[model samples]
Target: MLVAPFPPSHPLAWLDSHAARRREVGLRRELRPRSAADPMLDLAGNDYLGLTGDPRVIAGGVDALQTWGAGSTGSRLVTGTTALHDELERELADFCGAESGLVFASGYAANLGVLTALSGPGTLIVSDAANHASLVDACRLSRARVEVVPHDDPAVVDAVLAARQEPRAIVVTESVNSVDGGLAPLRELHAVCRERGALLVVDEAHGLGVVGPGGRGLLAQVGLAGSDDVVVTVTLSKALGSQGGAVLGPAAVAAHLVDTARTFIFDTGLAPASVGTALAALRVLQAEPDRPSAVLRAAAELADAAGVPAPASAVVSVVLGDPARAVDAARACAERGIRVGCFRPPSVPEGTSRLRLTARATLTDADTALVRRVLAEVLVPVAAR
Candidate 1:
């Protein structure tokens, strides 16, 4: 490989001096951890089921803590394998309609493991342009020939797969695009992949509780779950209101991942508390799937009442058209005791900035009304500016 060290002097040494320029442009981000006592109308998180604070969830974690102690101790292949891990994997696979499953410490790592393990040097990866950053980065790291098709355009994906020299290819997409909350045509895309003799991988990070029948996710809604060739990745951190993630697929594929996936083999297993919380939330979703629909309705109504209708999901994005204004709009909402997420360049693929809002099942009609008022006030300043 190589030896190319930077000389003692290079020409463009001024790049490091521009850190202040980013702050001046309002592009700088800072961390402020939300405490349980913060009296704010929360909408910036991914806890769509509102199960994060549920007594049952906390109780389950407490029980697991008593039983399994604190950490998983090591990677899944090593000393980390516990009864909790096995039980969570079994239940998640059953819920998602996959033959088997593997849990990861985090969803980001799960995506990395699945993509990198499945694709090799000669593989072709047809990915949606608007996929999550983790998936996009996975493609880059896979060293596979990547062809990013237009968002949700199965025809473009079909074309790319059709032209591939190596049809031993994989098609990667998010069932519900995270940025716009727009759903991809899963059945149609599945059929296209099948016709082209390609494997399909669906990221259900946003769809697990927000779409599909019984809140089983898009694969189940579209009747493609448990297929011989389909694979699914999901984050327990989202609607489940817990922590950790999973990769679901055929039994053979899951076994292969166990033997080869770097992320699964090298990373620590999920915490005992997170696994317990997720188990509780999954049971809750199984018991009351309609709660998600109610949240989706509230999200739709909240956006409509704001005079800025978003898509039909828990994720509601109010487009601000410019990055700077989007940040300012978010600030306005925060000042009013309403926390909202700001989407800007690099995070948003469309180059359009927005205020990203998530609707949780715990948000009542009264809560929706409050959010409506906040949106009206915050978005007004955006329009004037």
Candidate 2:
């Protein structure tokens, strides 16, 4: 078995061609450095409840750093899990009304962990066409027969699940679609899954700490939180104003994941700082239940100002049909001291570029006024251009 040596070429040359193609289509992206003291009004981040910089949350992180020495040191199955991790998992499960919970390094990993662990060659994964990329990637990695049905249509899901040849099935979706900020019909979806004997896995990344009673999540409000057939995954980074993610389900499911889920067993445990800050943030949410309402109100106000419908959650999307136009609109907002998120392909569908604004509970009246003015005087003209 003799192999001939090939002619030499620059190892990274292919990247230049790809970068040029992206630039031609207005899809190129670059990281913009942010300073700690930049005085721009922030509507670009996911801090829905505005607790990330809270003194209490900061103190929680500081204390954990002093105790845990900054890192988890190893994977959870090795030496990553700490007493803080255990406490956070227990409190998270209690808050969400689940029998048990397992923390992961990030929400993406949690999605991958659960989907890969639950489905395989003999499983059928019915995923929403508009599901987050994490779930989509997880399905591809699961070796399952995947069928993507129309967005928010439970009837289509039911039909697909009924026609699947696999013995075990699962339905994957998000409680709130990030781009359009529309709520999924979880009740209907749950009914279909239950009737078809399929497991329903809903990502509450945007729903937790922003929806439901006391911000427990949409499933809890619907009385489905601890249901045997329903599993929920949530991120602490959003309304919780921290980092890390968790999967909430039966104690049996958590135990199985500890033994089998690749992401959980192989990835480093979430840092003690993140766990502690998340715990403190959860307590803050519990104490100030009205914070969730404030976030909703802010979202509605922003949407109204932007001439869009009130969103289902704290995210409000303003669609600008062309990618270049959307980028210009975002830049105009930025020039006016407003920070907003610019979404283009493949983060969004082609020709549907948008400016994604997130509402915060801490937005003052002046901030709201500035956003309204930007939407009118800056964004409107740039989007038109």
Candidate 3:
């Protein structure tokens, strides 16, 4: 039998009304079940390099699981740190040219951990207006005075930093923005941060394995990788096709995070399987330098077909104006054997709901042709409407 609903005066009653409002606005979200072998041409996911199904990556994960069991067993400070974890951290730090690296359970956790630990009452944080949601949430959680500058404009960033009276400050930016795949002015931002004696924290969640020579990342491209004041956070789940996140920085910062970062201190360590798979993926990336370039090529091709600017990274957005139109476009793609992402309000600004597609290195010419046809067919009707 169905239980009676909560009373009208109950605190949870507000959620029902809010949900109804969302439904009216076509902003309500639903979880669509996906099978393991969907066989659709997938452009909606973040597996840019397409290493998730690579045999070597799977082998690495299997080996680690056999050796370390499944879970990390405890938090890193307790029994969580395994030999594989140590090796992965060392390799990641070496690969990225950072003095030290620390792993977190998820990219969200890593962003939260670093931002909260680094910024305090005496510190000011200048964030880009179009930064990721994780960064936005992190800034809020930091309790620091955060000034959001115009997106990708380093001059405004400089002005804000110059006007700040805080004893210390940090500038946070994503190397490649998650929404439109536009590249940030990293060199200019770094210069501004350096001149202001502020730390530069870059989230390389999208750029780490899809930008720079051999995919070292945008910081490496701008010669800021090993800089003492530059800190980077990356997710193993995106380009690496693994799971977990890591903060790369100077040894002192890493040490401080270990002692002070609540996410690191309290959360369970990243699983051995993810750590090993990331290690394998990194090594594969080192060996197969063309994969990164292939990802770029695919994104460029997709953008050209869609009449959008070439993507700076693996993501490309096709604006569909409203949430309902965007959803229709995505569903149309699905019916045509393509899986495309639909971005509505909250994921994007109210007026810019779009079809967000990610380019994968593993996508074939046939896949490209199919995408071109499906997008042309679906987007035209949506655009006309």
Candidate 4:
């Protein structure tokens, strides 16, 4: 086999064309770093329980850093598995009512690990249309036939599963849709999967620590936790105030992932500091069971201010239908000393670009009032128009 020589052209020139196209479509983005002591009221971040900067969480990270040094030093299969990792995994599993759990470098990696490890050529994946990008990517990488059905429609999922020729199938969805904050019909989906003999994989990244009793997770709330046919994936970076991901399910699933999940076998283990921080945050949630309700209340307040429907979780999305308008509204809010997220294509579909406002359990009445005022000024007028 003779290999042809590369074309005589600049290898990087195509990037400039792509950049120009993005700029023309109002899709170009830039990074803006924040200072450690910034005073802006933050509603853009995913710190739902407001534990990211809590003294206890900070102390936990500091302790882990002092004890374990900077990094894990290698992959988990090598020399990276610390006592902190083990404890974090066990505690997360126990909290979520799962028989076992396996931690990954990040939520995205966890999805990739579990989906690819569980499904292959002989498997089929029924994915929700509105699932997170990570789950979409995982389905693509799983080497399985994927059927994207309408979001939150268990009937379509059931129909697809019933017609699949593959010997095995997996139904993938988010317990709470990350963009629109819509809750999935989990019980219905579970029932469909059970009838079809398919496994259900729920990404609880946005649900864990915000949508269940004592922040256990949506699975526990819906009476499906620890089920042999269901698997849950979560991110520590969200409500847990840390930086890692985990897959929770039966002990057999964890064992299989440990043996064959490429992401887990190849990537460096999560940092010990993140493990310790997440553990402390979980303990705080257990001690302060009201935190989850507080988050929901804050989200409702934010939604009412924005004139959007009540959110199912901590995310309150106010769709502006145009990317430029959403960006301007977000900028206006920031100018008023309130920081909120501005999501546009391709984070969302066209005509659904919007502001993604996340509520924090620690937000006070004054903070809510301030946010309401800001949204009234910045978001309401545009939404009305």
Order of the predicted models by lDDT, top scorer first? 3, 4, 2, 1
Task: Check candidate 1 and list the clashing pairs.
Answer: none
In terms of TM-score, the best-performing candidate is: 3
Which residue runs does candidate 3 get wrong by more than 4 Å?
Answer: 1-10
Q: Candidate 2: where is the Cα deviation over 4 Å? A: 1-8
> Which model is ahead, 2 or 3, in terms of lDDT?
3
Summing lDDT over every window of 10 consecutive residues in candidate 1, give the lowest-scoring window: 1-10
Error of 2 at 212 (Å): 0.6
lDDT of 3 at 79: 93
Q: Distance from true position, residue 85, model 4, in Å?
A: 0.8
Backbone clash total for model 4 is 0
Superior by lDDT: candidate 2 or candidate 4: 4
Q: By summed lDDT, which 10 consecutive residues of candidate 4 come out lowest?
A: 1-10
Summing lDDT over every window of 10 consecutive residues in candidate 2, give the lowest-scoring window.
1-10
User: Per-model C-alpha lDDT, please?
Assistant: 0.86, 0.91, 0.92, 0.92
Ten consecutive residues with minimal summed lDDT in candidate 3? 1-10
Per-residue CA lDDT of model 4 for 1-385, tens digit only, reads: 2334444486866766777788787787878899999999999999999999999999999999999988999999998999999998899899999999999999999999999999999999999999899999999999999999999999999999999999999999999889888889999999999999999999999999898788887888889988999999999999998999999999999999999999999999998889889989989998998999999999999898888888879999988888888888988999999999999988898889999999999999999999878877886677666
TM-score of each: 0.94, 0.97, 0.97, 0.96
Which pairs in model 3 have colliding backbones? none
